[model samples]
Target: MSDTFDAYDDDGNRYAVPVRRSYINTSDLSGPGRIEGLPSFHLSGGGAVNRIDDQTFEIVATGKRLTVRA
Candidate 1:
């Protein structure tokens, strides 16, 4: 099963968001970097999961770094 927690940005500051992903299988929440309007996560096969909202994120990685709106 999975659980949810609060949301936070790169800084140690907390956000007003809820339902954060709580990994139970492993503890590897390493992210590549934050793009302007893209995701801050990087997959092994050049993929990313951009955070659109508190519970809405999309993949937009083409094996390369993407620069969206910070």
Candidate 2:
């Protein structure tokens, strides 16, 4: 089974998780792009989420690292 998690910033802002699309799963060309109710690691603006440990993550963008709670 797959586990779902929510990611939150230090200030308690919730990020909308995105459903990843790949070449093998391209049949649904016009479906909802985000996974609701889950926290997003991929920032909507820019940046990538890095796993620090269980329940903790780091947002890296523009040479800055911000803490994220997961």
Candidate 3:
């Protein structure tokens, strides 16, 4: 099966997205002095999944950070 799942935005918008696992790659970055190769989900509707921590994930769409549902 694929890593696609349902995620919700801050406005309670549901989206079917695909999860991208983290690895030792140089393609993912958050900032100039930060690393962002964590496990994230790609939303088909818009934006991306930003990993806040081990047990927390957020949706970043259109420059907005949204909460995810468990």
Candidate 4:
């Protein structure tokens, strides 16, 4: 995340700007998983909710990030 402002658009008409952009950190999870009984798991790739024993697992992520191994 990095940005600077001065592209003009208040009456100064320069509007061809692109700032504040920096993202490249993809590897949210790796192979090995058994979040049974809700030990510890909170995926941020957009979907992962598991609670074993009472049984409830809702894992959804097509935006990329899926690794589960038991």
lDDT of 3 by residue, 1-70 (tens): 2376665666777667777765554454663343446466667655666766543456665555545466
Worst 10 residues of 1 by lDDT: 15-24
Q: Could you list the CA RMSD of all candidates, in the order they appear?
A: 15.1, 8.8, 8.8, 19.5
When 3 and 4 are scored with TM-score, the better candidate is: 3
Query: Against the true structure, what is each candidate's TM-score?
Result: 0.25, 0.41, 0.44, 0.19
lDDT of 4 by residue, 3-62 (tens): 322233233433221223334444446844432231333343323433232322233332
Clashes of 4: 0
Assess the local accuracy of residue 23 in candidate 2 as a C-alpha lDDT between 0 and 100: 31
Q: How many backbone clashes does candidate 3 have?
A: 0
Model 2, total clashes? 0
Clashing pairs in 3: none
- Find the candidate with the highest lDDT and give its number: 3
**Local distance difference test, candidate 2:** 0.50
lDDT of 1 by residue, 1-70 (tens): 2222333434343332222233333334784443233224433344444556555334464222222323
Residue 41's lDDT within candidate 2 is 56
Distance from true location, Cα of 54 in model 2, Å = 1.2
Each candidate's clash count:
6, 0, 0, 0
- Segments in model 4 whose C-alpha atoms lie over 4 Å from true places: 13-18, 22-24, 28-70
